[model samples]
Target chain A: MRLSLGPLLYQWSRDAIEAFYAERMADPVDVVYLGETVCAKRRSLATDDWLALGRELAGAGKQVVISTLALVQAGSELATVRRLCRNGEFLVEANDMGAVRLLADAGLPFVGGASLNLYNVAALRLLRGRGMVRWVPPLELSRDDLGDLLGEARRAGIVLETELFAFGRVPLACSARCFTARHVGRPKDRCEIVCEDYPEGLPMASQEGEPLFTLNGVQTQSGAVQHLLGHGGALAELGVEILRLSPQPAHMGEIIGRYRAALDGACAETAVDRWVTAPLCDGFFRGAPGMAAAPDP
Target chain B: MKLVCPAGNLPMLKAAVGAGADAVYLGFRDDTNARHFAGLNFSDGSARRAVAHAHERGCEVYVAINTYPRPAGWRRWQRAVDTAADLGVDALILADLGVLDYAARRHPGVRLHLSVQGSATNSEALRFYADAFGVERAVLPRVLSMAQVERLCEDSPVELEVFGFGSLCVMVEGRCLLSAWTTGESPNTEGACSPARAVRWVESAGGTEVRLNDVLIDRFAPGENAGYPVVCKGRFTVNGATYHALEEPTSLNTLELLPALARAGVAAVKIEGRQRSVAYVDKVVRVWREALDTCRRSPEAYTPRSEWMATLASLSEGAQTTLGAYDRPWQ
Candidate 1:
């Protein structure tokens, strides 16, 4: 299985973002997705900067893909998506249908990101006809659901790389309202870009004080990190060509190294769990509640 | 602009039609639709009655088979499309591309309106649906502002529909997994959010605590009216402050913007509660119908009457309403 780094979902300073990607260039990840997938207001790195970083990553022998915004509401956002699709240098990850259509109209091959809901084989088949070379299934899909979809795809004679979200705090929802700005008592328009304060996102808890979600600008993420290190064999068996690890604040290189070790059979799958700081959850993979952690087999 | 009302059963369907709904949208009694609540939605027989009643009154009937079908349940969604078409419904509102593809090919003559759950926010996405599946109309998600909606309507390939009134979905449709994170089901996969089966309302010493699968969504103080326990609307602690971190319990009311919507060429205004009561359908549809007719007659002189606004607000979640994302400041 190949290791891929998903786009940065948090807001960081341009210097911090450059340093992070520069560090990631030496990491064991094979494919790197660069661009802001959360809030469009985060201009720590402009479109040109993202393109440059993508080129730098490609120069470091990493297959780079640029991801578009998950929710494109304004004409300007749509225009940004168009510009990204026209960037012929790197493969584009179409996060929303608008990006998908732009790429399809241009007849460019693209990766259907997790935000684009492809629940069944027929939907995947439709996108395949539109120049989609690979797809990351929705984060809510279970192992059984993924297995069923792949099985149907095989029966229908459709071919595309399957990339699964293997690690990170899974994004639960994206809203037009910025939760971070709301937390700081500001409207989304004049909020002064407060998301930069929390590089890992502000944590939210239930009334009982249990971790519930993380507020990352317009995106709300799972409080518990999704740890699928133990599912390496299952993923391979199910024909997942790539495993995507979302960029976190710390230990991303170490996390990538451990995933590489696990994939290479140099280490036990369970041993990789020690590196994850938050509580572990793989319940969505087990067709159960997302916050639930299934017992190890 | 047309006023599309929601109906869960035969009575609500009749009520909407009788109350001046230009079109009525509903779902089957299974996971084929987003409002897949227990004891809600229409059965096969009730759906046929709904179609007949709405059609007889010159109102169109739309069957929403909008959920993303898993491979194991693909045939169920296809069968729903076939059944809805065979029943002679005016349109089949669909979200899944595969389902849209199937409905377009199998029922070539039937009109297809893209459901809001499709999450096609831009003209390009609408063009994709229109070109790929021949979708006749598309419902824009509630994420867009008034200006964005106007911009999209200017260039959209298909007729545009926007939510005029409803309980607000804070997140973009088809993208929210908050319910699935707390429980195991979501509107995308299971066609339900915070599925009623997993909900528990406990009376505690402090207040009435509402929980979804034992996750405390909110605790209401004595005499505080509690709304449905949608995960996003729940109060939670964020950065040492407890509040409605995402959104408060409220509804979207665009009654005042009817003139602007009409001027923007919005083809339809949708009322968003199939899970609500027959009275809600009757009352809200009547109010929107009157407002829309008044707006159509004199767009320049259009102003929503206070009585109509009062009625809608009285029926809204938390007994309040906002312009939602339509107003720039709401975002």
Candidate 2:
């Protein structure tokens, strides 16, 4: 199976982001998703910069996909998405229906991002008709749910690629309010760029002191990283065309390397766990709570 | 502007219609709708009665089959659309693209309103729904500021509806997975969030603790008001301080924005509580209906009455309310 790097959900310094991508130019990942999927206020990389980066990655033989904002509320945001859809050089990931409409109207083939919430074969078929080439199901779907959907799609003669969010902190929700700013007692409009400080997002814990969620601007992600290195074989068996590993602050290259090695049969699938420092979970894969971890196979 | 109120059952439907609701929205008893709560929503017989009752009062009935249909249960959602259309409801409030496609093709005469769970926040998205499925009205998710809403009202190809009063959802509807991440059930798949069967409330010496699937969502101190243990509204610790990191336990009350909404030519205002009691449906719908009437009579002279505001406040979640994302500062 091919390995892909998901979009960066956290806000980092421009230099840090550029340097991160520079390092990924030689990483084992075959595909890379570029652009901001969270708050529009995050301008670490402007639209031109993202396009430049995509070209650099594309030149290096890695497939590049431009990811759009998951929540499109403002006219300016919609305009930005329109520009991204018209970026002729690379495929765009439509996170919301606005982007989907723009890309579909242009007859540009795109990836249906996880936030599109495709839960059934019929939804998949509709997007396919709209020129969607690949789809990332919402993070909450189980392996069985996906298997059933894909099975139905096959029976219905629908053809499209499937990408699974196999690793990193699972995005749990997105809101208009910037939780990162709110945590520091600042309004979303007048707030300083507080999200830049937390490269992996500000960690939040429950009342009883258990790690719960990661507050990254307007998005809330699971505090524990979702590790699916152990499911490479299962994913391939289920006809998963791509495995998406989200970017983290550190050890991303190493994580990508381990996934490559595991997929290549050079190492055991569970060996990648050594590179993931945070607690790991794969509950959604087993049809259980996402925070619950299934025992390693 | 039209006032669309939620009704989980027949009594709530009658209550909303009696309270001057222009339309009443409800769901089937099964998982086809977003408010698929036990002992809530209507069975086929009750749904028929609800439509007849609201029709008698000159109120429209909209059936919400808003939840995304699972592939295994896709037939159920299609059945719901056919049943609602068969019952002669005014419209079908839908979110799933597959279901919308089915409804538009099979029930050409029935109107289609895009549910808030559809997550269409821009004119382009609205246009896509209108062009593809003939959606007549699109409910905006509670994520846009007032300026954005006004811009949409001017640009949208279809009619626009905004949430007026309800328990607020901090996350964008249909996209949020926080509840599923914790409970393995979600509104998109199962039509429930923090499903009641997984909830546990324990009174302890320190306080009253509410847990979702044994995860401590929030703890209320003695005499502190306790709200439902929704994952978003729960208190959590960030850095070293404990606070409502996402949002507090509150409701969205847009009474003060009635004049502005009316001036913007908003097609309708929706009150969102299909899971609430019949009394809540009556009181909240009455307050919004009066506010809408006053605003329509004189947009320049309209002001929310203190009595209406007080009644809404008392009925709000946690007995408190805010303008939500409509006000710039709230974001």
Candidate 3:
């Protein structure tokens, strides 16, 4: 199994993002997704900068995929997605239907991102007809559910390269309203780049002070980190071709190293829970509630 | 614009038709639809009868097969589509591309209306559906502003239906997984959000505690009206203060924006409450019908009456309503 670094969902400064990717050039990850997947107002990296970065990453012998926005509302946002799709050098991860349609029309091979909501084999077949070569299943899907969908796909004689979201906080929702600006009492249009303050995301807790979710601009993520370090063997058995690691502000290199070791057969399959200090969850894998962490394997 | 009302059962369907609904949309009594609440929706016989009743009253009946079908459960949804077509329903409101493809190919004469769960927030996505499945109308997700909706109407290849009044979904539909993360089921996959079977209510020293699958969603103070335990509407702590960090318990009321929507040339106005009671549907649909008739008759003198607003507010969630997403500053 190969490790692919997923797109950055948090708001980081341009310098921070550039430096982060530059350091990852020598990392063990084989594929890297680049570009902003959240708010469009975040201009840390413009269209030209992303294209440049994609080329630079390609030059460093990494498979690069340009990711599009999760929510496309305005004409400008759709235009940005078109430009990204027409860049014509690297593969595009179609996060929304608009991106998918544009890529399909252009006859370019694309990766169906998790938010595309391809739940069944028929939807997978339709996208495959439209030139989708790979797909990332949504975070809420269980191992059994995915197995069923892939089984159906195989029965229909379609083979799609599957990637699993293996690590970091799973994104729960995205909205037109920027919760970060709303929490700070500013409208989304006039909010002054306040998301840059939280490198990861602002933590949200329940009334009794239990950590519940993370508020990241327009997106809400899980409070518990998804450490799937031990599930490497199961994922391979399920025909998962790649494991995606979402970028965090700190300890990503260590996280990548552990996943690399696990995939290389150096670490045991059930020894991943000890690698992270945060509360870990693999409930979606077990087909139970997604927040319920599977008991140590 | 036409008034599209929601009905969960035969009586609710009759109530909507009698209350001046131009059309009534409903789902089957299974997970094939999004409002898959217990003891709700219709059996095949009841659905056929409801269609007959609505057709007798010059009202249209649209069946919603809006949930995403798992591979193991695909046949159930296909059966639903075939059954709805056999019943001669007016349109099929659907989301899954595969289901749409099936309906378009197998039942060639059935009109297809893209459900909000499809999440076609832009014109390109609408065009994709239109060209691929010959979808006749597309329901816009509740995430667009009025200005954006107008622009989309201008560019759209098919007719557009906008949500007129309903419980507000803060996140984009078909994309949110907060419910499944906590309850092991989702609206997209399981056709229910925070399914009632997983909910538990308990009286504590502080107040009523609402739990979903044993997870504490919120605690209501003794006098603080307890709303449904939707994960997004619950109060939570951010930094140090406790408040509705995502969204408060409220409903989306667009009565005041009827004039603006009419000017935008919206083909239909949808009122979203299949889970509500017949009495709620009867009163709400009557008010919207009168308001729509008056507005279409005299656009210059159109204004939402205080009594109409008052009646809707009484039936709204949390006894509060806002022009959600229609008003620019709310976002």
The TM-scores, one per candidate, come to 0.99, 0.99, 0.98
Model 3 chain B weakest 10-residue run by lDDT: B322-331
Q: What docking grade applies to model 3?
A: high
Each model's fraction of native contacts: 0.89, 0.86, 0.75
Listed for every candidate in order, the interface RMSD values in angstroms are 0.8, 0.8, 0.9
lDDT of 2 by residue, A1-297 (tens): 999999998999999999999999999999999999898889989999999999999999999999999998888899999999999899999999989999999999999999888888878888999999999988999999899988889899999999999999999888889998899889999878899989999989987888889999899999888988787888998889999999987888889988889889998745556666568899999899999977745
lDDT of 2 by residue, B194-297 (tens): 89999999999988999999999998999999987899999899998998889888999999998888788799999999999999999998888878888887
Q: Sort by lDDT, best first: what order?
A: 1, 2, 3
User: Which CAPRI level is candidate 2?
Assistant: high
Model-by-model DockQ, in order: 0.88, 0.86, 0.81
Residue pairs with backbone atoms closer than 3 Å in model 3 (clashes): none
Q: B-chain TM-score, every candidate? A: 0.99, 0.99, 0.99
lDDT, model 1 = 0.92
Model 3 CA deviation exceeding 4 Å by range: A269-277
**Per-residue lDDT value at A226 in model 3:** 83
lDDT (C-alpha, whole model) for all candidates: 0.92, 0.91, 0.91
